[model samples]
Target: MTRRAVFAGWWVVAGAFLCMLTGYAVAYSFAAFFGALESEFGARRGEISLVFSISAFLYFLLGFPAGLIADRTGPRPVVVGGLLLIALGLVAAAQADTLWQVYAGYGLGVGLGIGFSYVPSVAAVQRWFVRRRGTASGIAVAGIGVGTLVGAPVAHWLIAAIGWRHTYLVLAAVAVAGALLSGWLVRPGPERYGLTPDGDPPLPSGASTMPAGLGLGEAVRSGPFWSIYAGALLMSFGLFVPFVHLAPYASDVGLGEGFGVLLIVLLGVGSTVGRFLFASVTGWIGRRLSFALMYVGAAAMLVLWSQSTSAPALVAFALLFGAFYGGFVAIAPSLAADYFGGRALGSVIGALYSGVAFGALLGSPVAGYAYDFFQSYTGAILAGAALCLVSFAITLAMPEPARWLAARRPGP
Candidate 1:
């Protein structure tokens, strides 16, 4: 059978999945090492936590340039380069003896690498299937859930067995292998292979059929874009609060390390389920409503989390909160494509995701300071719930872009 007979988009999705899996595995593993770093570096909670916050900030900040590069040059080179940086970052972090060295190595290095890898990979996959864009994007990003599921527990074990430094070394090797495999599998949009998106038949005129929507400049100036951007920023402020703090919080409330890790795994399970479930229903409910509902659910879960003091209660909160959190993350790229169109999607999506950087940058360190000052997570949890409520309101106000709405009507 000819190569075109088999859809190549699925292969691209697979490559995107592996890249996300490996990249996020390293990113999310930060929580597992939190305590070790604190003990090793003689740092306070806020001080050490800044490492993750700084890394997350750079991860989001660098996405803008990375996406621009991918839009111009394609995704393969970006992913390959990102993977190498991730490996190098880990290697540098593994050799570090000081807090600043750790920040320089793990924080900036991993952040930039993930920033390069993530936006390009997602944008590339979205270009392959218009009809199934939500599902395809959902499936690809579900790797974050899978990575968190496996990475947290593994990191916990590795830290216990061989120490956090060796764990970094091991993860560096994994990143290198993942990068090589991704280089082999990832390709640009279907046009590169002389096929149309979703394997559609060639047009009669043999002209390019890619949809050209709002250019980057127009998208930036539009009201709908700001609404979406605002919502993303607000949502992110609360989105990662738990990821960075829940493990340590569990310990403070007397839960053991094993249970703490289990909480993270449970959150990952919920995230996986939510991503697939919410994405599947977007066709019926529409992207905005689906996203808004998740925000409401997340806010409710955060409220419940703030009141919980027992193990069982925390587990329930972890699962519910994680599901809604994953749903929000899963839908973002599809929402951007829906609102903005495929042309310049990399740049538009990258710019939008910078909100994630600012939010995460503020969230982790702020929450850490709150905990250190008050000796309680109650205030932080309440703040997260409040941010989610604000995000939900903003999301509710967002209308489908005029351009997108115009494109849907029957021709005169």
Candidate 2:
């Protein structure tokens, strides 16, 4: 019997997966801690919601610099530094006696930590594959979905049993371990392994060592860049609302207490499936079309959430919205790589995500404010759906990747 040789690239993917799983496990687990933070601080919904938004804003905003640094210095050190910040943040937050202290620790610490690690790790995975770029990327980022799946419920249980402060200490330990392991696994590219991407045969010694593609400056100047950027910005305005609000939304509609974990679990489960399935099928459907569908489908599902008052209906909304949201996230970096190419891919991906970062900063807070003012989430949910529809239209106007690649300016 012959054994197939394992591709080393998958190890990189595994590293990325672990890094994201650990990082997002911290980020997404806030839902479980939401009630605790609010009750402890005596904060309102809008005030409590800012904690997640502030963190998301920093991470996304910082991802570009982290990518550039990783591109120059390698992903290992960047990820390590980032994870350390996350650990420190978790530890600091655990000790905080006031809301502002928690913000400084969790919001600033975790946000910047994820910024430094997440983009560079995921972008690193793209550099290691060509033929399987979409699927590989999907698998790598699926850690986010899996993290959301496991992190929320576990955090909830831990918070119930041991308390939120102790659970944070446990998370801090996990962040440190993630730092060490991910730093070891995430190399810059496939070149050093004596093989090309996808484990293809080695290039001749005389072949150009430089990867093919555009620089960060060149990529942001293109037509596709703005279209994609605008779409990302618009889509993100609604993007995080669900992750932050689904638990409370379910309760508002009379699903009862303790249902938060179930809704969050459903979201995680659907996202994990969506990442795998959407990414796996991109070869047949094309990444661009699938991405557009993600926008449309998410928008439609958000509308469902506005109308849902029953358990099954809310369940459907959580699963279906999660699937589309997961697909949108999983496809993004791969699609950008397709449009821009591999050269300075990390920086390019980072630049694109700035839109996402800024939009995420606004999403949940806006929903929180809307709910406070109107006393119903229906307005914010429908507004979120509207933003997604606009993003879908922008995506529809963009060219297919192959055509864009064929027309891209040469010699970056």
Candidate 3:
């Protein structure tokens, strides 16, 4: 067979992975820069944390529009545009001398850039696969973990050597290179290539193909969508709190700066493994059960994280939390596609991811404020654990989407 005949969808997966790796490397690497920004600006934790919170909010807030654009046009342009914005955001952030500048540059620019790239890439990947949707999505998102693993330590080293400003400049260059490379590779689904989703042959007589799911409005009005959204929002609340605070918290507990960054590395390791493992298993265990498992695991880990005071304990918390956290990230889009169908998958997934925006907006800064007020992370940790538990309950209570339920019933 010719090279193109071997299922070109995997090429889309590769492009999506590269885009995520580059974009998230810049996005998540903010944790490494968190302390430096605080020191440089003489800002409060809440203030520094707001940079990430704003970026995250815009990233998710814009997902709906980005996805709509992707649905109407295609993913390549969206991905390319996002990469340019990300580069510009980093460059502008590098030049910032004021908090408002940071907000505009990093928060608004980078946030919108990431938002533009994320949903489209994910939704595009969903459209390219059917039976293997879970595994394909998992593999694509594993880039986030890999990016974190590489980006966190590199950011730390660069900051120590050259300072955060230059580091941002360096990341900006990387973003440009990533965009140029991956943009060439990202295309729409199989139809563009004269194939079907998953590259499967035409179905035999009487075999049922899945229907296109609800329209954007119908999806919004559905109970299952909201259930997923609520669960995702709560889960994100628990997830990002530690992500932003873990570095600083390590320093507070006397683990030293090196250990603080090490925590991020460990989290990345666990996250990468979890995304691949948990999502791959969905073919066997199913999406709902897999999601519930991740929620419960994350909640349990957060409890452990709350009590952690030592290096080993924190390390354990990082691994467990990262695993479940990564699993949830990998599974969310797939779950949305499973319920909503691929017709309007971009818009549906984008709207659902807005939950992430709300969660991050509420979680990180509030945790920072709690720390500032009480001079302790105890309350923040407990709050995160509570959010995780709430998410767990919500996930359990979620019913199958109406489409899926209807599909399972016997036809006359």
Candidate 4:
């Protein structure tokens, strides 16, 4: 590949990154809209949460089909279609008169749209990289952190300036632009381009064989698959509590809500840095060491979070916490590919992420209700911290995939 080709690949990565970023900005930033939706629409907390909860449900539920379609059809169409759905959903939501209408428009429509976007983007990156798959994945997934960083503050500002209805219209316009860019930049398997990520030999002129690996059904039956799934579940269980409760926690500690909001921005910056930093670091440290260290560090920070009260302490927590979380997100899909080849990579990874939804669902309300019941976030933080510890232990049990040799095997 020439200089131009390398730059094209990077552009491809950036396009995928932007699509993933847009999808997450819409899906994950619901927390920023939560209070506003309730106050403006005269809805209760449970009613407001139901829309997002349903959105989360559809996002994970639709992922398997999305992955399968991407495998057979191609990534670009799936992603483009998903982006259109998101735009339509947001537009419909802007027109909603009742809470249930928002559920129909935002919850189901946008939820399904987000579900379709991730696997294709990840699959495209997988197709492009061989030697540096981990790093590439880290870079691509880092887009989510970048999107979150911008989306939260922007959403807040938009809501204040124009209210939720008009805010969603602006979001719809952004989604349309993202869709066009993704369709233009991303393509199917790398083999079609006459090369690979690290510059490899093409197939013999007469040969027609492709690399073989475990299918989703076969992969799920293996022990290593379960180990990865369990680890995801454990980590996700505690992932959002800190973000969700940060503002309220600041108020409890005698800080302004603005300070709490600012902490979220700090977390986003830390996460953004971590994604790129860990991508490069993994090249030097190796996956097992890097993963273990990050998980353990996250657990320690969660513990520290329980004792924190001051602004500086919370800021420190956000930085460290964001780093590990970023590492965890970037490494997960590549880790899946490592253990199981790209045979059913999309479906398998999607299923694993689906398990993650359960953990998050339990974590969010559990943290909120715990604070209500206990009048303190201490118990919630401890619960979240304990889940991090469990995630660390689970990572330890994961067997390393033996690379090219293991790639040829039926199981790890």
Top lDDT: which candidate number?
2
Lowest lDDT 10-residue stretch of candidate 1: 400-409
Model 3: per-residue Cα lDDT over 256-311, one tens digit each: 87888889988889999999999987878778878888888988888898788899
lDDT of 2 by residue, 1-412 (tens): 9998899889999999999999998999988988898789898888888999999998888888998998898888998899989999999999999999988989999999999999999999998898888889999999999988988899999999999999999999999999999888888787765568888766676342335888888888899888888898988888899888888777777775468668888888889899988997788889888899999999999999889889898889888888888898899999998888888988888888888988899989889988888888888889889989999998989999888877754765
lDDT of 1 at 230: 86
Candidate 3 yields a Cα-based lDDT of 0.86
**Per-residue lDDT of candidate 1, residues 1-412 (tens digit):** 6554567888888898899889988888888999999999999888877898988998888888998999999999999899889999999999998999999999988998999998999899888988888888999999888888888889999999999999999999999998988767778988777877777886886644567767889889876788888888887887888888889889988997678888888888888888899998888989988988888899899889889879999999999888998898899889888888888888898999898899889888888998899898788878878888888898888875554558655799
Displacement of residue 53 (Cα, Å) in model 1 is 0.8
lDDT of 4: 0.76
Cα lDDT, all candidates: 0.87, 0.88, 0.86, 0.76
Please rank every candidate by lDDT, starting with the best: 2, 1, 3, 4
Give the total clashing residue pairs for model 1. Answer: 0
Which of the two candidates, 2 or 4, achieves a greater lDDT against the reference? 2
TM-score of 3: 0.95
What TM-score does prediction 4 earn? 0.90
Error of 2 at 311 (Å): 1.1
- C-alpha RMSD values across all candidates: 2.0, 1.9, 2.3, 3.0
Return the lDDT, model 2, position 62. 88
